[model samples]
Target: MKPSTPTRLFLLWMLTAPGCGLLLGLDDFEDAGKSTDTVSDTDGRCHIDEDCPSGLHGQAVCDDGTCEYTCAPGFADCSDSPGCETAITEDPEHCGSCRSPCAAHCVDGVCNAPVDIATSASSASACALMEAGDVWCWGLLPNAEGGSRTVPLPERIELPLPALQVAVGGTVFTGPHGLRAHFCALLADGTVRCWGTNQLGQLGLGDTGPHEGAQIPNVNGIREIAAGTDNTCAINAQNQLYCWGPRSTGLIEGDTTPAAPTLIAESVDQVSVASFHACAVMVDRTLKCWGLDFYGSLGLGAGGPTHATTPTSVGHGSNFAEVSCGLTHTCARSSSGVSCWGNNANGQLGLGSRTNYNSPQSLNLFASQTLRAGASHTAAVIAGDVYLWGSNAFKQMGSNDAFDTLLPVRLSLPSVSRLALGERFSCALTAEGRVLCWGANDHAQLGDGTLVSRATAAPVRWR
Candidate 1:
């Protein structure tokens, strides 16, 4: 039954109170699909504020027995939807009025110069490469908050010079090593610098002095950089591979000289590293991999050596465009399609099965522009559509489901230009220059300013 006028007002006030519990039944709320404009107490519309869902537009309320979204004082709703989806105070599309687009861009809802954003992720933290090569980092860090370990928002990080690329990862170690995460930046001048935990020399600074950041001596003209648990590798302009940090032999990188960068290979075009292995794209478009292969992550075939101390060709093709390494698997893209090999536990291989493959198994997905691998998940950008497979324990799949998928599933997002996968989270850069992240946010890695893990894409809020 509809409540009386006085009773409706009281219910609305109670619903808007801070920390007040909702005692209303489900039937009291109106459906989102129902428009509020026609709502009337006698017309079987909404009779009270509780009759409408809160947060429908911003925070909803009942006015004169009619349900509508309530904006803060001086705030105006500009979106043409049933409720106010955008606040005129800061909405770029409705800066001051409905359908009024921002002149330059929108920031915090206000029109300003549109910002360009590029993102990178480590196991627990994330970094954004912004305009003019400035970098901002957030999430969990070793020295954050008296060592309490979580930075909930983005903070500009000072580097010796503007960085072109950044890589972050947590190295797995035992006893005194445990897990130490580190960061590395590739400078515009073609040099590489590193910071954070140096327990295993992941920083590549000659000495393990736990410093803010330091440039690696003698190594210059670097074109690309990739990091794993306790090691860092880079491809020089001359197409040579240089590596530092602790040894994880058979990954084509081991400690022949513990204090300096060691030359691993030459004529390499690109490289990627994860837990205990690494892969590289050769000049001929062929792929090679090394390191622990107990899970067939090397894609060297079941007859190949269990561990390859040197680079071994992956599969029998030279048509690969890129390759990525995960915790216990490897994936690559070719003119034909995407394929993965190694441990399929949790379906990280994305072959529609939990069974591991010793040889390259075609995923039959679309041709990919780029791809990335996480601890137990894989993501790819195929003609702008983002597809994820394998583990969704933390919703890294971005499918809004916690259950794992053995096959590729397209994410509900705009065309993506690039992708990055973390231990239990995923992030992407849309063609529109926006950064969106999802999955685990216990350490605020998703950058929504909340530690809440998201099952769907959330814009990376920048203050």
Candidate 2:
């Protein structure tokens, strides 16, 4: 569905009010001067929900072939009251019930943590780092299916230690025998833990046995971690890089099996893992990439190796703050502008053409604040506005269509603070601490409690 522009106050209400659902066409509430007990369409004319008036006291729907008002989701009529009169879930005066008070903050109809949430996504699942220092996951199960394949909603996960951040990898061919997908957690104590799909040694578990559950590796002093389609990498406090997983084409070099974390480079500031390669930003602000460059993803000059098993310098320009790797391309934010290279068949390069480039190309159009690359698309934040380009087969570009763009298209969303891109979906964390997503929802990865795809940004239901 096309998500409408929401006012600040309405967004606040949605975030704090449990079961509010996504109320549409209710922005002009001035006409609703006084609350009404019930609302009915006297003019017997309506085929869809939108045909009803906007100011109706509750959810407006076609009931019994007539327009009527009902309580929104997560809201209900008081036992003593019926019809349109309602009790909200998070309201302190009606906390989960009529006339109840909350001792703390109300969340999902209950008083709980007041912290802003951080969200992460794997290919088929997404996880949230809650304010209470707990991680909750929702969406499709990695290798398991049916009753065991989906969580459907956010469910708390038991971790041995408090997780500061979490990263999830894709599910396709990620396990020891290519049988499972995985996710990794960076704990508050600077330690690293990983689980699932150890077949390729992505878990760095030393052995591939016990492919399920979490594994706490002795590796310590880690500061940042990133997971890829099948492998994982981390940068320690010392700025050294360590990686583990199956050896595809020397992305990690000589590793043939599930191996312990191996140091790859030093003085690394940030690291990003893609489907078949990885890129890093060094303390000197230079970019380096390794692994398969079948489509010139490494961004090395034409004279450079087709594929570098070891890290190779990208372009001469230093001043890079961060870098992100996609399925077959790489994007980095430099002091000058956003630089992208590699696959352009889907216009992911945002270079205004489908032609690929072997060297870094600057997008001199806008001042990029942040950048994220998906399987066949790229999203960058320019002055708080997100611009998306490349594949939109599932409306991942928030245009509500399947057309591809050779140039960047601004997403109609509020100022974005961060972005996470899945294989065929995209999510943005708003400045207000709310999560919004669009694109494919085959596995409920969009996290709106539905399996329907959205062409525009829609709030992810945390409640």
Candidate 3:
């Protein structure tokens, strides 16, 4: 029953008076339409989802009057913070996603990948072409001052277009005149770009100014390129060979200056240039060589001729697959096996002896997929294994023992797809696209972020 207004007022006043024991109940206020449930008040933390701040990993949201977060792909909120904080793109411990570990390197959400690698035979520098069409280099790199300097870690090289192949060439002399180095990159458009020391017009820019991104003039449709101590060569899609630079050892004939490309030979499949000589494998699988034959490097038989001004046939067969020219030696792979000629002062021929061979001398090993001849060393990949010989004074053989060997010695490594050799160092490209290097690191040629030389293979540090 409802009480009179005066009686209700007296009851409320008695409950509110001092020393009153009864507590005020909401039952009397129900008729005023008041809510019984608790309502939340956000004390300026956030009013809407857009009011919350986003962190490195991306977006945030407001829910139940509180700010919550969401992570973008390749990121995660692995910590107790209110923002997404972890990046899984390059973290080996959590590559691509949380708890997805990688064996060696993590790059752009993938693991252990590189496409091609090139090392200078004269200086301690190297470059690698990544699968993403970017180029990274280390060791003695070219500086903007038209000179070169040593770098202990990998640095990205800017290019106007994607690169298909990269080649490094240089020459080291005694005394104050130290190193003359250069680099060339073949773009997807069949144009060539070069930079570095251009004292002899090796950069192919029509002038010797140590330029960068200098394109070879009047040349297009080139399929391959090779650089030597002070010269460069290219082979167009039509199998025509062209060469430029100082006219030495018959590399260039007549009054053609070193500043312009000149036609050298035709139907050439592959060509390799060195300090004073050059060699090529014709389309018919026949090997031809010209230039100064130091210690019979031309493979024209002992006591034959000291120099050949024109392309002359070498060996006795047409099964030649490829050839590599070194400082004073040459090595070639034919259908039979691997054969080497010329300088063997350090047993670079892998012939199990210190005696130099004027003609082709076959090694006991079988066919090789890739072969390289350095200043005084040689490296070959046979059945996925690396075989190295010649000078070990710099521990380029991937062994701690600094002793020269005349026979080929196997390196402790995984399946190798390709190999590149420097004067005192070596690098190999693994089947998994990972790059491993050893030997001289005086200029950080190994790309391991240190100047200390290594006797065994170590993974390159990208960062």
Candidate 4:
């Protein structure tokens, strides 16, 4: 139900009220799909430096939402505080506060970014990548936020104390030093901590809290972490994978969130979490998944007679280097090329059709090493060229076509060096040191300049 005019006015009036309660209401009222928010933020509105919080040091905020900052090119805190500025420039410690301002991209006092890979459990909680392998998180972390869009990037979280590590067996600890009691760092010590919303036991902490940031309990020796839709998967130094959330239908992304990450029942060198599923590459390059396949995201079967609760092979293929999953579809790549399947309502399957597919469809487009799946679209990078397919209702496909693409369309972005896929938007890193994004500008995730959706792509100067 839409709020009435008087209700909107009431909301605005309460915006100035007391307590963090207002903040909560603001967060709740802001419409869910938004990946970015700029309401009462000091830098919320701006022009030049003086109009900004820190006074003089940021981008202009035209009718559209764009704020330049003093951080490095690809990073901005957007704090805009009186003395500090916005998070784009918030961390005096990193940029203005700390020494590694641009590098750390701190928000508040902790290094962080607001973009989270939303899904079931990891949603409400902030996914934190700690320094020296100590990961921690804070905020409305839900133990059941599920759906994909959980922790997309590592951010610094406000820590009243050092991060506490939760064990696979449900043992909890406080402080980084204590985590070492039964755990060993792995994967160059890349720390990925998850809290808030853990129904499937995705936190691996003996099950507790559906929307609270309680550290998982038991077990030890950990490193990297990835949250699927309803599961949580982690890795140790030996490249071993351990998942526990929604094991049935690959929803085992830890607690109960699908795609959070659960033991796929396979040992692999790598893994990738998708909307309601997850994929992994064995040492020999074999691909496997353990989650929902109603849309054929799990491969093996067309999904439908029903969903599976355990890991399944993705067709006997090899040299499969990478794989990605979306809401109703799945796509992966091998030495031969890319193959995808599942729901094509918006062409998310990338198989060149809007028709639902229960069978595998070869992209037969350009070849690439990286593959990404969006809620209803698919993207892949072949060398430096980016190609996309599927639904374009919100331009999530990155092209100017308002309809779905039966085949892949090569997107030439000379300014782009890297590519990332969001739920409804696609972004890339430019060779000229800039950020280019397009599609579903609704939540301002496009970071372009306006709320208007785009059929083509646009450049976003994050700095």
Q: Name the top lDDT candidate.
A: 3
Error at 436, model 2, angstroms:
1.0
Point out the higher-scoring one by TM-score: 1 or 3.
Answer: 3
lDDT of 2 by residue, 1-463 (tens): 6444233333454456433332332321111112223222243444555543323345565455555555555454443222334435565445565555443345566644312332222366667665556776666545432112555556666788888878777553344344245778888899887765555556677665545555656578889888887688888889999887777636776646655778889999999998778899999999999988868989987888977888889875899988988888888998888889998999999988999998899885557888898888888888889988899998888886678988888888988877888778888777655667788887787778888888878876656
Give the Å error, residue 395, model 2: 0.7
Alpha carbon lDDT of each predicted model? 0.71, 0.70, 0.76, 0.49
lDDT of 2 at 399: 80
Give the C-alpha lDDT of model 2. 0.70
Candidate scoring better on lDDT of 2 and 3:
3
lDDT of 1 by residue, 257-342 (tens): 34468788888999988767888999989999888886898889869988887788887677888988887888889888888998
Q: Which regions of candidate 2 are displaced past 4 Å?
A: 1-122, 143-148, 172-179, 211-213
Error of 4 at 11 (Å): 58
Residue pairs whose backbone atoms clash in candidate 1? 90-109, 105-112, 171-229, 250-291, 250-309, 251-291
> For residues 215-294, what per-residue lDDT tens digits would candidate 4 score against the true structure?
34332355555444444566655667776554443344233333333344536676666546677777788877765666
For candidate 4, the C-alpha RMSD (Å) to the true structure equals 16.4
RMSD (Cα, Å) for all candidates, in order, is 10.2, 12.7, 13.9, 16.4
What are the runs in model 3 whose C-alpha is more than 4 Å off?
1-72, 76-86, 92-112, 175-177
Task: Please tell me which predicted candidate would have the highest TM-score against the true structure.
Answer: 3
Deviation in Å, model 1, residue 248 alpha carbon: 3.9
Per-model TM values vs. the true structure? 0.74, 0.74, 0.80, 0.57
Residue 96 of model 4, lDDT score = 31
